[model samples]
Each structure stands twice: as C-alpha cells, then as structure tokens.
Target chain A: MGPLFPQEIIGEELNILIGFFIGIGFGFLLEAAGFTNTRKLAGVFYGYDFVVLKVFFSAAITSAIGLFIMNQYGIIDMSAIFYPKTFWIPTLVGGLIMAFGFIIGGFCPGTSMCAAVTGKIDAMVFIGGALIGVFFYAYTYEPLWKELRDSGAMGKVNIAEWMGIDSGLFILILTLIAASAFYAVTIIQKKVTAKGDYQI
Target chain B: MERSKKYMNPYLAGILIGVFMIAAYYFSGEGLGASGALKSVVVATTDMVAHDYATEHSYFSARVSDPENPPIKTWLVFEVLGVLVGAIISAAFAGRLKLETIKGPNVTTKTRFITAAIGGLLFGIGSQLGRGCTSGMVMSGMGVLSLSGFIGLMAIFGGGYVLAYFFRKLWI
Candidate 1:
C-alpha cells in the first residue's frame, strides 16, 4: 500500500520530486540539531556532548518501532521495501573504517555536506577526501575488496531473528538501552564540561 | 550578532529524523542515504570522462543502467542536494553560519583539513566496500533490524571508540 515509488503507487517523476522534498526536511533537521558542527558530532565519542548519540539511537529505534507497527496495522507492506541484505563481514570491516574516518575527519559524508553548505573549511576537505576515497575504492574494488565484500552473506536476517527473540522485545530492550545511554551521556556531559570553559 | 543559538533538543531532533526515515521508506521504498548519492556522482563523473574504462570497471558496470543516461540522475543525489539546502536554511535561522575550521584546540587548521580529507577518503572507500555509511548502512539498517545494521553500528561506533584515542589530538 505504501512505498509509492518502488510500488508504482505514484508516478516515477513525482516520486523523485517527493524524494527532493523529503531530503530537504532531513537535511534541515540534521543541521538544526547541530549535526553540521564537527565538535558536537565529536562530542558523542568524547562524552562532552551526547547529541549525536541521542539523536542517532533514538531515530533508529523510532523508525524501527514505527515500521513494525505500520506493518502490523496493514498500513504499509514492509516486505516490498528494499531491506538491505546482511553482509556481516564487509559491513563490520567497513563500519570500522568509517569510524576511524569519523574520529579523524570529524564528519560523516552526510554531516560533511551539511557542514560544507554552512562554509566549514574542514567539511570541504572531507568532501575532497570522500571523492578521492571513492575513486580509490572504485579502482581497486575488484582486486582488493570484491571477495571480502561478498563474505559473511547472511541474506536479510533481522536482528531479532538472529537473537532468537521477539522483535518487539528486542526493540523494547533497545529503547531502554538508548534511554539509559542518553541519561548516562547527560551525566557525562555535565562532568566533562564541569572542569573547563569548553566552548562547543 | 548574538552568540550562537542552542541547537534543537537532541530527543526532539531524533524523533524528527526518525519520522523522516519512515517517510523515506513509505514514499520511496528506500531509507535516507548520503554516501550512495555520492557514489552515483563518482560513477557518473568517471563514466563521462572515461566511458570505455567505466564500462570495463566492475563497480561502475554493476550499477550502470542505461549507457546513455547519466549515472547521477538517481534519488540519493537529489535528496543530498536537498540536504545541503536544508542545512543552510537551518544554519541561517540559527545564526551558526560561519566560515571556520573545526578541530581540537591543540590541532592546527592545516592538520584538521588534512585529517578531514584523509578521513573522508577512508569513509568513502569504506562506504563502498561496506555498502553504506552511518546514515545509509548503520541508521537505515538498524531501522529494519538487519544484522548488517547492528554489525555496522558496532563497527562504526565501536571502531570510533577504539580509534578515538589515537586521533585524540584531532578532536580533544
């Protein structure tokens, strides 16, 4: 019933247009939440600011719960959407690499775009780096990455399934975990900012 | 004129972002992504400059739809473009729009830029190898409760924690 574009519920051109509008809203919230600020983003790792952690975890849980409920109510066909296959090894390795990038570079690709728009010089540099990285990966993909990329192919296994538990229970546990993390970070933020006149 | 404005409450912002992600899935049958859009740009550029080479290349060829139509004409690209505009508007409203380099107090601007570039390059390569970035892989993957998402979450966040000390000078 939903997923207007992929399901052909809406015209192709209109779907793209909708994508544009939705992207704008997504970007706006990212920036308004101070995602463009490298320091704020960095704070998640450092315990000075927990905004990134709070925002990221909350969003994921919210979406998960919403989708689950929507699917249950028959409002949307969750199966029709493109649920990415679980390539565990590559994803783990890749995520580790990206994490290193985030710590060193202080911006993810999406946040960097937001930062770049607001005239952050570092964000621009990150953009250049991303392009170079893309080119590098592209050129060496077949030789260096192709095999590893296909490793650990656990084809579309949900986390709940893998854990041998109910999705609702998993989500509830996740939500509780997220809430605790948010609370812990708030405490850490107070402690971290207490000793110094840090201007974040 | 005044000091920078405070950002939106993190929880509120998270819920808003969550709603957006849901909207993305509902309307487009996809979730939000930033890196995949960038990949399309890279592929399109490479194809435009070196058509024969692009066709021969494994990655480009894998995703190439029409040989004539540009690879950049995809959903993520337009979505990313909107992200830029939206971020700008938000910044303007908040008065946080400034031209500055962000880094740790000890880190030099030159060092920051260099690291930013290197980090970005690493992220770009990793996203392709891993098949998504934080937004695309980690966030969206988590939404569907895919094991890939959790693995990615651990990798990126856990990896960051592991590497943070080494790069402490960059952000601390």
Candidate 2:
C-alpha cells in the first residue's frame, strides 16, 4: 500500500522528484539547527553544547517509535524497507575512522554539504579532501582495502531480534534512554559552558 | 545588512528531520543517504572517462554492467541535490549565507581547512569500506532495528570521543 516507488504507485521521475524535495528538507534542518557551526558540532565531545547529541538522539528515537507504530498498524511494510547488513569488523574499524574525521573536521558528509552550501569555506576544503579520499580508495582497491572491505560477512540482522526482545519494547526502552540523555546533557551543557564565553 | 541569524530549536528541527526520514522510507522503500550519492557520482564519472577500465574494475563493474540502471539515475543523487537547494533556502531565510571559514579562534583558517580536508578524506575512505556513513548505515539502520546501525553508532560516536581530545586545538 505504501513505498510508492517500489510499488509503482509513482513513476521513476516523480519518485526521484520526491527524493529531491525530502533531501532539501533534511538539508534545511541540518543548517537551521546550527550544524553549520563547527564549534557547535564539536561541542558534543567537549561537554559544552549538547545540541548535536540532543538532536541526534531525539531524531533517532522519534523515527524508531514512529516506524514501530506504523508497522504495528500495517501502514507500511517494515519487512520491505532496505536494512543495512551487518559486517561487524569493517563497520567498527570504519566508524572509528569516521569518528576521527568528525572531530578534526567538525562535520560529517551530510553536515559538511549543508555548511558548504551555506557558505562555509572550511566545508569546501573538506569536500575536496573527500573527493581525494574517494579517488585514493578507488585506485588502491585491489591491494589495500578489497579484502578488509568484504570481511566478516554476517548478512542482514536485526538488533532487537538478536537481543531477544520485541521490537516495540526495544523502541520504548530506547526512547526512555534518549529522554534521560536529553535531561543529563542539559545539565552538563550548563555546567561546562557556564562561564566559558565560547560565543558562536 | 542584518547580522547572522539564530538557528532553529534542536528538538523542533529534529522532529522535522525525523518526519522526513520516515516519509522517505514509506515512499522509496529506502532510507536517507548522502555518501552513497557521492559514490554514485564518482562511479558514473569514472565510468564515463574510462569505459573499458571501469567495466573491468571490480568496484565499478557492478554499477556499469547494468546499463539500464546507471548509478547517476539513483534516488539518493536526486535527494542530495534537493538537500543542497533546501540548505541554500534555509540559509538565505536566516541571513546566514556568508563567505567565511567556520573555525575556532585558537586555530588559523589554513590549519582548520587542512584538517577538515584530511578528515573528509578519511571519512570518504571509511564510508566506502564500512558500506555507509552516519546517515545511511547508522541512523537509517537504527530506524529498523538493524544491528549494523547500532555497531556504526557505537563506532562513530565512540571513536569521536576517543579522538576528540587529540584534535582539541582544531576545535576549541
């Protein structure tokens, strides 16, 4: 009944058009939330501003809950949605690499695009760096990363099922944790930035 | 001219983003992704430049073999283009569109720009290896309770915390 493109409820052109609109909304929100500010983005790790944490956790929980409720009501086919397959070793190592990138750069791929479009010169440099990295990987694919890339093939697995819990219950618990995190971080932000004068 | 404007409330912005993410799933049967779009762009461009080599290489082969399903004709690519448009609009409305480098007072613009480039390069390589970035693998995966998403979340956030201190000069 849903997933218009997959179901042919919408044509290819319209489907992509919708994607374009949605992407714009996503990008707009990222910039509007101060994600364009490198200092604000990096503050998550420094215990200063918690906007990144708050927004990320809240958005995650909100989507989780919304999807669960929709699935329970059969509004969307939860089973058909594209879920990423787990490759534990690569993801762990890759994530670590990305983490370093985040702290040093103060933006991820998505946020960097946001900042770049909004006139952040630093983000422009970051994009150049990303292009170079992509080219490097492409050139050295056979020798450097091909093997490690395909290692630890676990296929697609759901965490809720792996943890032996109902999906709904897991969503609820995650929501609670996020709410608690928001509360804790608000206090931490106050304490950390109280007199620092790290004005944006 | 007006001073740079204030940002939106994080919670409210998060909700709007969350709704869009959900809508994306329902419409396309897919999650939000940014890096994949870039990868597609890279693949398409490379294929065009070196058709024989592109078809021969393992990385570009899968995308190139399917003549009907070119990488450039993908949903994420269009979505990303929209992201640029949307971001520009929002920046314009807020009077935040200015040509400047976002950095800390402690760091020179040159230093900040260099580090940002290096960071972006690493992220680009890592995303290819990991099969996704924060939005694709972590956030979208988590929406459906995928274990990989949790792993990505842990690795990226954990990794950031571990490295943040060493990179403090670049930021604070």
Candidate 3:
C-alpha cells in the first residue's frame, strides 16, 4: 500500500516532483547543519568537532527506526523500496578511496554540491574534478573498471540478517553505540579545541 | 560584515534529514543521491557530442541507449537540481553566500584547490566502482540496514581516521 510510485499510486511526473522537494529538504538540512563548511566536515577526523558523526549517526538511526515502524504499521512496503546490493569488495575499496577524498577535499559528493552552489571556489573545482573522473572511468571502462565493478556480487543483504540478529535488537545496539560515541566525541572535542589554536 | 547565523543543532538537523529520507522512500521508493545525477550528466553529454561513439562504448551506451528518454530526465537529476536550488536559498537566507576557498590556515589556497580537485576525482572514480557515494550508498543504504552501507561507512570513516594523521596539515 506504500511506496506510492512503485505501487502506481502516483504518476511519474509527480514522483519526480516529489524527488525534487525531497532534495530540497535534504540540501536545506545539510546546509543548516553546517555541512557546507569543510571545517565542520573535516572536524570529525581531527576531533575539533563531531558534527558529522552526530548528524550522520542520528540521521541513520532515525531513518532506520522510522522505516521499521512504518513498515510494521503497514504504511510502507520495505520490500518494494530501492535498497543497495552488497558488493563488499568494491564498496570497501571504493569507500577507502572516498575517505581520502573526504579528508583531502574536505567534502563528500552531496556536501560538495551544497558548498558549490553556495559560492565555494574549492567546491566548484571539486565538481570539475569529479566530472573529469567520471569521464576518465567511462572512457577506460572496458579496459579498467568493468570487471572490478561487477566483482563481489552479493545480493541485497542487510546487517541484521548477516549478523543473525533481530532487526530491533540490532537497531537498539547501534543506538547505544552511537550514544556512547557521541559522549566520547564531545569530550574529545573539548580537549582538542581547548587549546584554542584551531578555529573554524 | 554581518556575522553568519549559527548552525542548527546537529541532532535536530539529522532528524529532519531522516524524516526526509523516510518521505523519499515512501513516495518514490528511492533514497537521496548526488553522484548518480552527475553520472547522468556525463552520459548525456557524451551521447550529445558523439552519438555513435557513445552508443559504441559500453559505459555511455548502456545509459544512453534509451533514446526515448534522455539520461538527464532521471529522478536523481531532478533531485540534484532541487538540491542546488535549496542550498542556494538556504545560503542566501543565512547570508553565508560568499566566494572563497575553505582550507586550513597552514595550507595555501592553491594547495587546497589542488587537493580538492584530486580528492573529488578520486571520489568520482570510487563512487563508480563502489556503486554509490556517501549519500546513495552509505547514508541511504544504512536507512534500510543494508550491509554494503555499513561496509562502505566503516571503510570511509575508518580509512579516514587511519589516513587523517598523515593529512593533518590539510584539515587541522
């Protein structure tokens, strides 16, 4: 009864429009959270700020819990939604590369877009670089990336299933971990910024 | 100069974003994404410039083969357009719209730009290989407890922590 578009309860045009509005909310919240600032993003690694960790974990947990509840209430069909397949090898390798990108560029893809639109010269350059990278991969696809990209074809799997734990229990454990991490980071940030040498 | 307004609380903002994620899933059966739009743009550009070449290449051809609907007409593309609009509006309201390079005081602007470009380049390649970037793969995937999302999240954050020491001058 849910996932309006998938169930044909909504038409394609309206679906795309919904996507636009959702993107607006996404971008607005990102900026409001200071994600447009590279310092705030990089602070997670440097311990000067834990905004990224706090925002990321809370958001993930919120969505997870909300989706679970919605599915439980029959308001949404979790099975019909688009979930990413687990290709462990490429995801791990690519994720490592992205980590370097985050530290070096000080922004991820979404955040960079937000920053770019908000008049960040560095973000503009980053976008250019991303485009060039896309082109590079596209041209060299057959020779370089096709095989690796397709490797490690594990079908759509979730952590709860893989760990042989109940979904509710996994969510609870994750929330506890995030809560503890949040406390720890607050302490760490106080210590690091107490030096007063670093300013964002 | 007027000081920029303080940012909203991170936790509150996260909840808002989470709610939006839920809305996205409920309405469109998809989640948030950024790089996917760029992929569409690239495919569309290649198809426009070299119709035959694009069709011949597996990467571009696979995407552009649907002649009836261009790649730019995708849901992610429209969503990205909205992201740009929303960001601009938010920045304007906060009076934070200014052309500048964000970097550590220790690093020169040139170095920052160079590193950002290189980093973005790497991210682009990685997203293609990884099937998505932070938004598409990690955040949205985590929403549904996808295993790849957790794997990607650990790799990105853990790897960042490991390499953060070496790249200290860049951020700190």
Candidate 4:
C-alpha cells in the first residue's frame, strides 16, 4: 500500500524530489547534532564524548520501532524495499577497513560531505581521497577484489528471523539495550571529562 | 553571530532523523545513502572518459550499461546534492562556517591531512567492496533488522575498538 514509488503511486520525478527532501532532513539533523565536527565524531572512540553512540543507537532503535509498527499497520510494505543482501565475508572485512577510516579520517562518508560543505579543509581532502580510492577499486576489481566481493552471499536475510525472534520483539530488545547503553555512556562521559586531560 | 551556539540535543536529533528515515522508506522504498552517490559519479566519469573501456570492464560495465538513463541520473546523487545544500544552510545558521583544519593538538596539520586522505581512500574502497557504508548498510539495515546491517554494525564498531589503539594519537 505504501512505498509510493515502488507501488507506482508516485512518479519517478516525484520520487527523486522525495529523496532530495529526505537528504535535506538527514543533512540538517547530522549538522544540528554536531556531527559535522570531526572532534565530536572521533570523540566516541576516545570516551570523552558519547554523542555519536547515543545519537546513532537512539536513531537506529527509533527507526527500527517505527518500521516495525508501520509494517504491522500496513502503512508500508517492508518486503518491497531495497534490502541489502547478507554477504558476511566482504561486509566484515570492508567494515573493518571503514572503521580504520573513521578513526583516521575522523569522519564517515556522510559526515565528510556535510563537513566539506561547511568548509572543513580536511574533509575536502578526505573526499578527494575517497574519489581516488573508488577509482582504484574500479580499476583493480578484476585482479584484486572481484572474488572477495562476491563471496559469502546470503541473500537478504533478516537478523530477527535468524535469531528466531519476532521482528517486534527484536525491536523491543534493541530499545532496552540502547537505553541502558545511554545511561552507561553518560556516566562514562562524566568520568572522562573529570580527568581534565582530554578536551573535545 | 553566536559563535558559541550549542548543538541540538542528540536524542532529539536522533528522533528527527528516525522520522526522516521512515519518510524515506514510505516514499522511495529505500534508505538514505552517501557512498553510492559517489560511486555513481565514478561510473559516470569512467563512461565519459572511455566509453568502450567502461562498457567492457566488468566492474564499470555492470553499472554503466543502463540504456534507459545515464549513471549520474540517480536518486542518491540528487539526495547528496540536497545534503550539501542542507549542511551549508545549517552551518550558516549556527555560525560554524569557517575555513580551517580540525585535528588533535598533538598532531601536525600536515599529518592530519595526510591521514585523513588515506582514511578516506580506504573507506572508499571498503564501501565498494562491502556494498554500503555506515548509513546505507549499517543504519538502514538495522532499521529493518537486516543481518548484513547488524554484521556491519559489529564489524565497524568492533573493528574500531580493535584498531583504536593504533590510531589513538590521531584523535586522542
């Protein structure tokens, strides 16, 4: 009933417009949450600031719950969405590499774009690096990464299904976990800030 | 301008983003993405530079051979353009628009620039291999309880914790 574009309720032109508006909302929230600041993003790893964790977990849980409810009420059809297939091997290896990128670059792709627009010279350089990296991967795909990228193809698996739990129940459990982590991180942030040596 | 303006509460910001994600799914049947937009740009560039080669290479051909439209006429590309606009608007309102480099006090500006570039390079390649970055693969996947998303979440965060010690000087 929902997913207006896929359902043909919305035209291609309108779908692109919706994407633009959504991107605006996303960019605004990221900037408002101080995600454009490199130090704030990197702060999660250092324990001086847990904004990244708090924001990230809260957002994930919120969306998980929202989606679960929407699906139940028939507001949106989850099956029609573009779900990512589960390719464990490449995802794990690539995620590890991205983690290093996050630590060293102090920004992810989304945040880098936001920061670059906000006049962060370092972010601009990081973007240039990303372009170069994408080109390098494309060029070397056959010899270097083709096999690894295609390995471990588990198609569009759901985590809750894998865990043998109802989707709603999984959302409930995730919400609980996120709440506890939020409380824990506040204490950690207070303790870390009290040390006075580390400044964000 | 208030140079010291405080950021919006993170929890509030998170909720706002959550609502946006729902809107994204309801309308477009897909989640938000950043890296894919860049990938489109790469595909388009290659197609432009070497039409024959791009159509011949397995990697580039898979993306570039769409006869209906060019690779750059994609939703992510437009969304990313909107991202730039929204970010600039917010930065301007917050009085945070300044041309400068950010880094730890201990690190040299040159070192920060070099490391940041290298980090971006790795992320670029990794996102391609992994098929998505944090926003697309991890966060969007988590929303729908996708296994790939959970694994990505763990790997990225776990990997960060594992390698945080090595890059401690860069941020800490």
Candidate 5:
C-alpha cells in the first residue's frame, strides 16, 4: 500500500512529481522555521538562538517516531525505500569538514539552497563554490579521493540493532534526550540574549 | 528595510516537516534529501561541456549512462526545483523576499563572502565523499535509526561546537 514507487504502484514520473510537492513543504517549513537566516542557524552553536536545534531535533524525532510506528503497523515497507549506508571513517571526516562549512558558510546544503533561491547574495556565491568543489572532486577522484571515500564500509547497519536495543526504545531515548536539550537550550538562549541583544 | 511576518514556531514547523518527510517515504519511497541536486547539476553541466571526460570519469559515468534516470531527471533534482519554488513562495508571503547579502557587523563583505565560498567548497567535497549532505545523510538517516546518520549528526554538530570558539568573530 505504501512506497508506491518501488511497489510499482506509481510510475517514475509520478514518484518524481510527488517528490516535488513534498519538497515544497520541506522548503516552506524550512523558511518558516527561520532557516533562511544564517544568524538563526549560527545561533545554535553560539547559544544565542536555538531554533535550528529545536526544529532539527523535533523534525528528526517526529519523523523517527512516526515512521517507526507506521512500520510497526505495516503501513509502510521500510525495506522498499532508499536507506543510506554507513561509512564510518569517511562520514566522520566528511562530517567534520561539513561542520566547518556550517559554521563558516552559515548554511548546510539544503538550507543554502533555499536561502539562495530566496535571494541571499552570499548564498548564491556559496552555490558557486559548491559547484566548483564538486567539479574538483569529480576530476580528481581517481588520484586523490577515491580510496578514502570508499573506506570503512559497514553495510546498512541500524543503530538500534547494533546497540542490541529495540527500535522503539531507542527512539524513545532519543526523544527524551532531544527534549531535555530543548529545555536546556531555551535557558541558555535566554541567558545569552539577556546578556546582550545582538542583531543578525 | 521592510518588516516581515514572524516565523512559525519551531516546534510546529518541525511537526510539519516531519509530516512531509513521512509523506515522502510513503509516496516517493525516500526521505528528506537536498544535496543530490547539486551533484546532478554538476554532472549534467560537465556532461555538456566535456562529454568525453564526463563519460569516462568513474564518478560521473554511471549517472551519465543511466538513461532511465539521467542526471537532470533524478528525483532529488525535481525535489530541489520544488524547494526553490516553495522557498520563493514562503519568502514572498513573509515579505522577506529581497536580494541582499547577510553578514556579521564586524566583518567586511569581502571577508564574509570569501569565508562562505571556502565553506561551501569544503562542504561540496565532503558531501560527495560522505555520500550525502546534512538532510540526505544525517537528518533522514538518523530518523530511520541508521548508524551512519547518527555518526554524522554527532560529527557535524560536535565539530561545530568545538570550532565555534575559534570562528566566533565570524558569527558573533
């Protein structure tokens, strides 16, 4: 009944069409959550604004909970969908590099796309830089990056299974952690803003 | 500057985003992803400019050869197209739709732009190396309890906190 694309319940065009609509919602929510603002995103690290953290955790946990329950009830086939593979070494190194991008660029790939579309000049420039980066990678793959990117291949491991815990229980624990962090961040944001209100 | 409407509460926005994500899984059989388009654009553009090189390259060959899902016709490309439209609509509705450069007060426009370019360049390479960006890898991956996603989540955020002090002037 679900995963219409893989099940042949829908054609590729329809799948792509539906994806487009869903992306609209994603973009709308992103902008509505103040994600277009670099300052808002940067605030999470600086303790000045936690909208990024709050929205991010809430979205992730909510999707986790919702999808997990849906899977339990047999509404959607998790296996029929595209799931990302785990590459610990490269992921760690790449993620660290992206962290510098986040702090310096003030936007991740998604947020930057949305921001650039909505007319942020710096975002447009950032897109240019990303294009160049991708080109550089594509050209130099054989010599410079191929090996490192392909390292540490652990195939499709779920964290819950790896930890020897129930998926539901793991999600519950994650939710609690996110909730507590939300509470703590709210307080930190208050203290930081109270100290001095800076403009973004 | 013109005043814009206040943003929606973060919690509610998060809920809406979750609903959309679930819908994506239900219909398209994918979760939130936004960086694939960047790669696609690169592949397509490269294919056009240097067809021989693109076709021969290991990185771009598979994408270029796949007729059923050509580089430009990928799901993420359409999705990102919609993101652009949706973002434009939302920004317009919020009265925040305008062309401007955002930067910290302490830094000049030159420094800010240069920093942003370098950051974007690094992120582009990292995303390709890691197989996805924040949304495609970490956010959606973690939602499904994938170890890769969780690892990325910790790395990016943890790394950010560690480096924030050094780059404080950039933002603060």
Candidate 6:
C-alpha cells in the first residue's frame, strides 16, 4: 500500500506535488538546524559545536527506526524504492573530494542551495562553480571518468544484511552508538569551547 | 537591523527531517536528495540549448535522449525547486535574509570566494562519481541500512577529520 508513486496508487502529478512539499520541509529543517551556517557546520569537525553530529545521527536513527517498524507492519515495501548500488572505489575517492569541498567551500550541496537562496553571497558563487563543474563532467564523461566511475560494483547491499544481522537489531546497535557519540561530543564541545569562544 | 530568530533545537529539527524522509520514501519510493536534481537540471539545460549534442553525449544522453520525459521534468527537480521556495520562506520569517559573504575573520573576501568556487567545483564532480551528495548518498543510504552509506559516512567525516588540521585557518 505504501510507496504510492511506484505502484501507480498515486498519479504522477500528485507524487511530484508531494515531493515538492517534502522538499520544503527538508529545506526548512536544514536551515532551522543551523546547517545553513558554515561556521556551525564546520564546528562539528573542529570540536567546538556538535550540532551537525547531533542532527545527522539523530535523523539517521530516526529514519531507520521508522522504516523498520513500517516494514514490519507491511505499511511500506522497502524493495520498491530507488535503492543505491555500491560503487565502493568511486565513493571513497569521491567522498574525499567532497570532504575537501566541505572544508574549503564551507557548504555541502544541499546546504549551499539553502544558503544561496537565503542570500549567502559565497553560496551563490559556489553554486555557479558547481554548475560549471557539472557541465564539465558531462562533456568529459566518456574519456576521463567512465572507467573510474563504473569501478567496484557491489549491487544493492546494506550494512545489516552484510553483517548477517537483522535490520531491527542493527538499527538498535546504531542507535546505541549514536547515543554514546552524542554524549561524547557534548563533553568534547565543552572542553574545546572552554579554551576560547566559537562565534558563528 | 533585526537579528535572526534563534535556530530550532538541533535534535528537534533532525527528528522533523527524519519524519520527512519517511514520508518521501512512503510517497515516492526514495529518500531526500539534492545532487540528483543538480544533474538533472544541467542535463536538461544542455539538451534545451543543443538537443543533438546533449542526446548524443554518454552522460547527458541517458536522460536527454528521452524526448517525452525531459531531464528537468522529474520528481527530484520539482523537489529541489521546492527547497528553494521553502528556504526563502523560512529565512524570511526568521529575519535571516541578507546578502553577505560568510568567512573567517582573518580571511579576505577574495580568498574565500576563490576557495568556495574550487570547493563547489570539486563537490560537483565528486557527487557525480559517488552517485549522490550527502543527503542522497550517505545519510539516506544509511537510513535504509545500506553499506554504501556507512562507507561514505566514514570516508566523508573520517576524511574531514584527517584533513581538518590542514584547513584549520579556513574555519577555526
């Protein structure tokens, strides 16, 4: 009954409309969580503020738990979704590249978009650069990136299944880990900020 | 100038976003994403300008080759459009809308802009290779217990921590 769009239980127009509303909520939460602030986002890595960690892990745990329960009750079919394949090699390399982007650019793609719309000048320039980059990639896809992009194909696998553990149990473990990390970050934040103020 | 309202509690905002994620999956059979829309928009724009070139290119062709379903006409694109709208509304109500460059006190506007441009360029390339950006790949993947999500999570933040010291002047 769930995943209404794929099943055609919902019309295409309706599904798109729903998606827009969801995006609005997503953007709102992102800005409200202070993710639009580069200083605040950077704080997670610098040990000054841990808001990013708190929000990220909290959201992940929440979604995992919610999905698990919904699947248990047959409320949604997890198999129907646009599941991602694992391109381990590319992901690793790409992730490192993105990491540098985060440090130097001061915003991720989503946050940059949100910040750009809210009148962040740097974010506007960042988006401009991204557009050029995307265009460049498309032009050079076959010659330069085709090989690396398609490398290391592990199809449709997840952590719980790979570990040979139940999804519910794995989520429980993840929640526990996140909880401890949340606690640990709080303590770390206090120590770091004690040395000097962190202004965002 | 009126100061911006205090941000919503981080955990609360996270929970609300998580709820939105669940809804996204339920309604559309996927999670939140940002980069996919970027790709779509680019492909569509390219196709609009030069239909033959876009449809012939290996990467753009995948979407642009389909005449009936143009690259821009998709759920992700609409969702991203809504992100812009929603961000505007939120910033408006919070009194946070202003034009300014965000940077460290020590950094010049020129240096920050140059870094920002380079950073964005790299991120665009990375997201294409990795198949998604932060929201789409790592976090949403993890929501479904995907291994790629965990690997990406580690690679991103782990790499960030490993490299943070070098970029200390950029933020701290």
What is candidate 5's lDDT per residue for A1-200, written digit by digit as tens? Answer: 68888899999888999989998989988988889888888889999999988888888888888889889899999998778889899999989989988889888889988999898988888888888888888889989889999899999999999999999899989989999998999899889988986655
- Residue-level lDDT of model 6, residues A1-200, one tens digit each, is 78899999999999999999999999988988878777888888899988988899888888989988999999999999867789899999889888888888888899999999999999988888788778888889999888999999999997898999988889989999998998899999999999986766
True contacts kept of 1: 0.88
Tens digits of per-residue lDDT, candidate 2, A12-67, equal: 99889899999999999988898888889999998888888877876777788788
The list of candidate 4 runs beyond 4 A from truth reads none
Task: Give the fraction of reference interface contacts each candidate recovers.
Answer: 0.88, 0.82, 0.84, 0.82, 0.77, 0.76
Q: For every model in order, what is the iRMS? A: 1.1, 1.3, 1.0, 1.2, 1.0, 1.1
- Residue A11 alpha-carbon offset, candidate 6, angstroms: 0.3
Q: What are the clashing pairs of model 6?
A: none
- Please provide, for model 2 over B28-87, each residue's C-alpha lDDT reduced to its tens digit, 9 standing for 90 to 100: 988888889878878988999988988888988999899889989999999989888989
Candidate 1 residues lying further than 4 Å off, grouped into runs, are B65-69
Quantify all predictions' global Cα lDDT against the true fold: 0.88, 0.86, 0.91, 0.88, 0.88, 0.87
CA-RMSD of model 4: 1.2
Question: What local lDDT score does residue A130 receive in model 2, on the 0 to 100 scale?
Answer: 81
lDDT score, candidate 2, position A145: 86
By lDDT, the best candidate is 3
Note the DockQ of each predicted structure. Answer: 0.83, 0.78, 0.83, 0.79, 0.81, 0.79
Global fold similarity of model 3 (TM-score) = 0.98
Q: Which scores better on TM-score, 2 or 3?
A: 3
What TM-score against the true fold does each predicted structure earn? Answer: 0.97, 0.97, 0.98, 0.98, 0.98, 0.98
Which ranges of candidate 5 are over 4 A from the true structure?
Answer: none
Give Cα distance to truth, residue A98, candidate 3, Å.
Answer: 0.7
User: How do the residues A1-200 of candidate 4 rate in per-residue lDDT, one tens digit apiece?
Assistant: 78889999999998998899889989988888988888888888878888888788877888888888889999999999878999999999999989988888888999999999999899999999999999999999999999999999999999999999988888888888899999998999899889866654
Writing each residue's lDDT as its tens digit, candidate 4 over B1-172 gives 2464788899998888888888888899888789998899999999998999999999989778887767898888888888888888888888888998888768999998999899999999999999999998998888778999999999999888888888888877
- Write down the lDDT that model 4 would get: 0.88
Worst 10 residues of 1 chain B by lDDT: B62-71
* Residue-level error in angstroms, candidate 5, position A17: 1.0
